[model samples]
Target: MSQAPVVGVAVFVVKGDKVLLGRRRSSVGHNTYALPGGHLEFGESFEECAAREVKEETGLDIKDIQFITVTNNVFTEAAKQLHVVAVIMRASLVDPEQLPQNVEPEKCDGWDWYDWKNLPQPLFQPLETMLKNGFSPFPAKLN
Candidate 1:
């Protein structure tokens, strides 16, 4: 039997014209500012995964979660193979001032909010696309 695909979740938290981003921990795409997210555990719902990943990676609690897109990522590195089905979501901050708890210190070097119009190109391609498209890729579905 083919194994169930690994599902991942990402959050694009926006306020005004700026969006929240996190720098990756390792060298896979090190020093790059990407959306805050991670893979889901077994039996966890997509919304729960989005909330958990955002908090773990950025120390931010997000609510009013909504789905965006479901895409498959096939990774080919050396002899290892990884298939990731990513679910993107939109959410509002519970409280920005609240210090993120249990953050993986080594995973992310920094976090910043960037203006959607002037995002740094070299480190943020996917984000650039998402913002440029007016966030149309994410449809709002409150559940």
Candidate 2:
């Protein structure tokens, strides 16, 4: 049997009308636009991993990770079997004034704030689906 692919976490962090985005560096899909988060290191909780990834990639501290959707991605076109379990989280910014420097500049080409209603195509695809149709696997309690 083929090995199971790696699991990762993604956060759709929002502030006002903008969402945080990370321009992919040299990973699975280099130079692609993606959420500002990544995989969970061994021995780390999903929430902790989410926070650490956001801080490391986008120079932002995130807190209070709420449950979102999960994506099971299988890359069959790469000639190599790679599966990814992405746990999408809804988190908030801990501080807006103190954006840190990108720890891995090579992995993140740039960061930008785009309007939610009209996001660039680079930030489209699955993210657009997430925005339009949120998680429905479980009941969500409204405030």
Candidate 3:
């Protein structure tokens, strides 16, 4: 039997002109850069999921969470197919002075802020999809 597609929440925490990203360490997207987020929990709103995932993975508090866009991602690894519906969100860090740390060493290495125009290479599949679709979290550019 096949499993249903999982819904994931990808949060872009903006601080000044940069967005926070984590270098993944897990098998799913190992060695790829991705936003701080994870699978959505039952009965949880997108904002709640974003905040929770950010804090849990990056140790940062985020607020003003808002919907950005969604990407339908279907990919395969090790001959195993996987499908994920990625719900993208954008927000600002609640405390600008607080730096991001690697809270989940098993899944992520550490977090860093990067400019949108010059993002790091080898981004996670879903994030790459969003960029290809011209999805920008910045208010000045939506496409």
Q: Which candidate has the highest TM-score of all?
A: 3
Question: Which ranges in model 1 have alpha carbons more than 4 Å from their true place?
Answer: 1-5, 77-81, 99-102, 124-143
Q: Specify the poorest-scoring 10-residue window by lDDT in model 3.
A: 73-82
lDDT by residue for model 2 over 34-135, one digit each (tens)? 787777899988888888888878778887788677877775645566688888887778886655466778888777766766666654245655656653
Ranking by lDDT: 3, 2, 1
lDDT agreement with native, every candidate: 0.70, 0.71, 0.88
RMSD of 1: 4.5
Top candidate on lDDT is 3
Residue 97's lDDT within candidate 1 is 65
User: Candidate 2 regions off by >4 Å?
Assistant: 128-143
Q: In model 1, how many backbone clashes occur? A: 1
Task: Rank the models by TM-score, top first.
Answer: 3, 2, 1
* TM-score: model 2 vs. ground truth: 0.79
TM-score, candidate number 3: 0.92
Per-model TM-score, in order, reads 0.75, 0.79, 0.92
